[model samples]
Target: MARTTSLSGFPEWLPEERIVEQHVLDSLRRTFELHGFSSIETRAVETVEQLLRKGEIDKEVYGVSRLQQDEDSSREDALALHFDLTVPFARYVVENSGYLTFPFRRYQIQKVWRGERPQEGRAREFTQADIDVVGDGTLAFRYDVELALVMIEALSELPIPPFVLRVNNRKLAEGFYRGVGLTDAPAVLREIDKLEKIGAEQVSRNLQDTVGATPEQAEAALSLAAIRTEDTSFVERVRELGVSNNLLDEGLNELAEVVGEASRRAPGKVVADLSIARGLDYYTGTVYETVLVGHEQLGSVCSGGRYESLASSGKKTYPGVGLSIGVTRLVTRILSRSMAQASRSVPSAVLVALNDDASWSAAQDVAGQLRARGIATEVAATAQKFGKQIRYAERRGIPFVWFSSVAEDGSPTHEVKDIRSGEQVAADPASWQPPAEDLHATVLRAATTDD
Candidate 1:
């Protein structure tokens, strides 16, 4: 037999790490549900046409097929693992439009696959927690405002680095580009998307060679991307550019609304960064990019935006605004940087100690009783000395050890020892309960000197 190796980009967490991951997931789910967002799931696979219908991301898509294909198989064209949740969700909305409500609010948490080169915060397969509000034909700008509010609220509860959400609008970027004589704005937008990676010089050259943008035009594009404002003063700043268009005005009004409302509700959480022209072509309105306070190098940890027409039929259209948090990226950073800690490696709050081999089944019965009362309990696996049993519980971070006994008159009694504090107290299995905070594994952050 040979030892197996870990796949390069597929992340697998140990039990302790998974504790933090579950905490993050639970916190996200609670926040989303609290906001009245219903949950829905889409199939992991979608037709290749549905994925490629929007843009040229074929290289990042992983195609799916069976090991052996018959000549007469019913495979139409081909299928691929979805690279993101939005496209598949779009198809789902159109397919289920008839039965769905007018304003559909959904939260989808699932693994998505991407074949891109893996790096820190990047993976071949990852999980995304998304909340989208989709409307029939026309959606309101308030949803855009609400999206930012929900994200800031949800992320504030997670154990990770502080984050700042960067917002921009497609109309602003496209109008700015068009106002600068760049007709092929999408190609230019793609080039600008790589501005951080390829540097301003390379991006300018690509803009010129790829889209015939001159040096002046390239500088203007870079200039627009460089603008970042914390307040609604961004409106005046864009006006300072001295370039005006009807679409630009529309975008400015919408951006002002989102930024103003976001500032009023969740102060200092979001900012207007004009350079945030997201890579997706479907985004027709406001866009988002997020960076941690100290982890800007890792790029956006959460991102999504408004799409004017994502889902459509011959007569109907679905417009939406959404935000997604990359759960894997978040938990990875938490573990790698020691951003947080799981209070226990396992869920057991109390380990039932066995007095002797004859008491094994009795301990099991006691464990069941504690579990029935909503305490996480696990019976000792073997009959061991009390010291050895307590040692076992200590190794697993189990806080309490329960010892079974009977009174002189044959009445049942149990005592649980708190390993950390060395305190023993009488308890009844049906009535005993761990403190609320200790009832389950908890995720905590390491204290910092600044704190």
Candidate 2:
């Protein structure tokens, strides 16, 4: 049978592209570590019961179970691949509450499975970078502020340009809805969240038809949600709506503090967007969605919000706040636009050519010396022609090639060449070094067609 093609939205990049991906991951990990967020990885699978505890994720779950494990038909083991890291992390925090430190700050970067249909940036199998701070009921507000700041710094490290961290307070949205005579909080917020997709008129109509709102009241609520003041004016404007519910006042205060703190850290990065209602049903406090400036049409590259309770074991509540970067989406966008890149591979500095059968062992000594000096060197597997060996290095994007030659008098010498420049130099393998910049290939801006 003919080989099946790679399924769409399931991307498999070449070695060079993999290098770019790894570089992105490495930079993200470094930023997380710099902020003192410890790393933790949960298993890929969790019980369906554990996953469905939060009602919002049912549509995207990819269930898993053994195909032939039912011979006895008496025992059962059910599991599903995790759709997001936060839920599993919450479960881990609850179960291992005793072992973990209070105010736990952890960062997890892993592949998550979503059974949703594919789109341009959305994939069936994708990676996400999530950082969260869960506490033993005493998380400082500073942690919430820092989480957004750290994500900003991490994403800024990528080749992509600036992105806006659109933030809102769920409490603020709920409070305003209550003041507007709406009772069901999630249902109301869900409708408002569609404002970006559906026009304000349609959103207001939906509010009237679905959530029982008068036409004028729906327009007023949509106007409040559409309010996008630069700073404290957001709070002032929302209050000006004259929604008298105490809950609205409280939500406005909570968001005021969060936006105020985030502004102090990153003056222009965070904005109070009342209409930025994330569809997640769990968020009860501050919510966030980040969009690249030029790529706004690509939608949110990172998004999350504060959850009042992630796990309810019928006994206790776990309040938490976190954010996630859609790694696959952002990376694919970068690739398509030639926004970033990486070296061909992880090999350090040199590729030692195989001169002849007799000189193979001698070349090994040179490679051993280079390796001892912290250089990555590889010897050719076969003694091919000089041209063939040079092409091998070029194909791999190996910057330097070490050529070995045995003189007629049985003396051995080695020369190094920079394949790109076609410059060759005599060198002692033990002491030679490539320029620091030449040691690694980086993402280069694509040249114009005319060039």
Candidate 3:
């Protein structure tokens, strides 16, 4: 069973629960590889300066240093655990630019630390699975759409509730804010990002008080955020608001393309939710946020965006688009809500019974033969009674129990029993096979009950 620990932010899962998490990770890896994204892992620690350069998350950074320092030791360099994968990935791209191919595509799944208040969905330490495509200079906008589709396919494979991949362009939000006389686009966006949490009225007031937006401008900004659609109709909807600028036109065109293509490719999975501002400052173009259909209160289970100037050399810049799945949070919710669970705690499908000390070698031979045939078989640790051995297999959730005995004619005989069904039959160790589902530990969705 999973137990609560003294450390509040960190979460630990039981063996069975971990099986469910492994299933999710395996599903994500298979999907990402199918799309041709290579895997890479950056060191957990980066300089504090490098980490704080992209976002305003200073308090959340966990600094790293030696406990005992020499008086002569210099403190010129400081290190910290990375809060997200994107920042570290940007550094990886710039340092390895010479060795990497242009338009490099990579996927990273690792633990990230944050110094925030732990809650139902948020944690201080968690795993994030990220997929990104970085270009040499200019990355195509279609990647924004492709990433959404990829993530949609990835999440769909998991045994979770339906989710909506909410997408919006920073250019669209910034251009609309500019047109509405909100000079500080980031500040306005930061306030708008709180709309769902603080309510529209408070966000509107904050816009006027902090962003220096007039009443009319605040209402206009809110109106723009209120726009959402499943298709290209959002174009005319934004135009009807009468906010037009060169940047706005560009943003509208880009956003329309994403929404149109995503809806056609994976209908109803993508939503053009204008209200999603993605509070991070590094996002300069398209942004994404995903929420489960009925579990919206748990917050976004996945999110990321496009950053044009995040990774750049002196003369060369790498623009990229990506999305990250909150693996820990998603698994936590799945386990807590009983969405799915591992079929068994152990991987062994057959437990070979030991009749006596003298028969142990014969039992080992039987187990070896079963294993050679791709069956996960385990021999009894001691030559205990058959009932006790069967009880052992029952406790471990092993489905089949094998027995070896000498027949009336002094010929060796083998039999297998399905504990659940109470069925036993003679079988050959080399050719006997369990059901397909019994070959390995599988994730089983919880049965739903009508309310």
Candidate 4:
């Protein structure tokens, strides 16, 4: 007989990690609501045609079919699992266009499936946190900058350090591509996007080979991409680099206005990077990618951009800008480096023991009382020995345990033990309150690295 392994790319976590996930998600929902973003969830499946409306992303879409049961005659016409939340949201908005308010601000946190090869941070199935504001006819540029600021503010509340929000505009990239004497802007962008994976020399080589760029022109484009600045001075730098064209100037002005507005609201969070060429095809304006401090090698933990129009019914158009944080990726990074640890295995603050079969009902009463007082608790299912019950409580990381003691007349009293300190104290079942800080587990500081 052989043991089996769990499926890959469909990761499942234990109860403690699930609690942490819930905490993270709840925090996100609260933050979104605080800033007046409504929430909605769409069905998991969409017709293959609806998904293929956007061009490049269709490659990663995981189409749904029942193949294991009836392989011979399954309808091969695929209905794809959404690769990201935005596409489905766009469809949703179009389908329900008449009902939604203009500048519809919505937040969706859901699991999306992609059929990509699994790696360290990339998953076949993962969760994304998306926020978008779609307007009826034309979306406002102010919301574009404001939404980026809101994301920066929300993520700042997390334990991670100052992260860089790398931004660029497709319009800017297009302008620069044309200025470099290239006709197909997107083809050039595809080449530039590989700069991180392929070295600068290879990127230059690819540019020349594929997009027909002269070596000098390729080097100039690379120089423009590498020009990273912390402030508005980057605009003047691009202009001085003499990449001035009508499209370039227009894009530069938009970038400046967006970065300026974002800075006023969220200082030191946004940066204009010419190098960011988001692989997605639909982003027509500003594009963004976020990197955690000192973890740039892990790549963008969050990435998205502006879509000029996602939903079209031939009579209506909706343009929107948004970004999604890869929640699981960030969590995986935190877990891998031991930057954070759960303080407990379960949500329980206390465990009431079944000292003996005779004491079971009494233990249940204590558990109920604790729960009624808003403490999470569990009663032992079987009447195990005192030592065994204590070990069980400790193993579960239930900080406190209660032992029900029968009165001489068979009534009940309670004794509680704090496992960490090895201290036992007489306690009243109804009145004893755990210290405020001990009511729920708290995230503890892990061992630090100088970096």
lDDT of 4 by residue, 1-451 (tens): 0111166666666666665566667778888899999999998898888787776776688878776655454344557788889989999999898898888999999999988777667778888898999988898787878878888877875555568888887787789778878888888888889989997899999999998999998998888888776666778888777775788887787888777777666667788888999887888888989998788887898788889877777867899989898987776666667666677868798888886787678777778888888889988888877788889998888999887776899776778899899899999868898888788876654566214
> Candidate 4 at 283: error in angstroms?
0.2
For residues 1-451, what per-residue lDDT tens digits would candidate 2 score against the true structure? 1122279656677667776777788889999999999999999998887887765767799978677766654313568899888889989888888798877888999999988788768888899999998877556666667788888899878777678888888888888788777888788788898988888988988988999988877877788888875466797788677788887787788777778877887888888888988876777788899988777878999999888678544566667789999988887877777776665554556889887867788888999998887777888878999899888888877888898787799887789999889999998887987887765665554442111
lDDT of 3: 0.92
Number of the top candidate by lDDT? Answer: 3
Least accurate stretch of 10 residues (summed lDDT) in model 4? 1-10
How close is every model to the real structure, measured as TM-score?
Answer: 0.96, 0.93, 0.96, 0.92
Question: Residue 162 in candidate 3 has what lDDT?
Answer: 84
Write out the backbone clash pairs for model 2: none
CA lDDT, candidate 2, residue 292: 84
lDDT of 4 at 29: 86
Worst-scoring 10-residue span by lDDT in model 1: 1-10
Superior by TM-score: candidate 1 or candidate 4: 1
* Candidate 1 wrong stretches, greater than 4 Å: 1-5, 72-75, 449-451
* TM-score, structure 4 vs. true: 0.92
Kindly indicate the candidate among 1 and 2 with the higher lDDT.
1
lDDT per residue, candidate 1, 1-451, as tens digits?
0111278678888788889899999999999999999999999999988898886888999989888866675546688999999989999999999999978999999999999798789999999999999999898789999989999999999877778899998888888889988888888889989988889899999998988999999998888888888889998988888887888888999999999998888887889998888898888899998888888888899999999777888778899999889998888888888888899999999999988888999999999999988889898888888899899999999999999898899998889888999999999898988888889999887774111
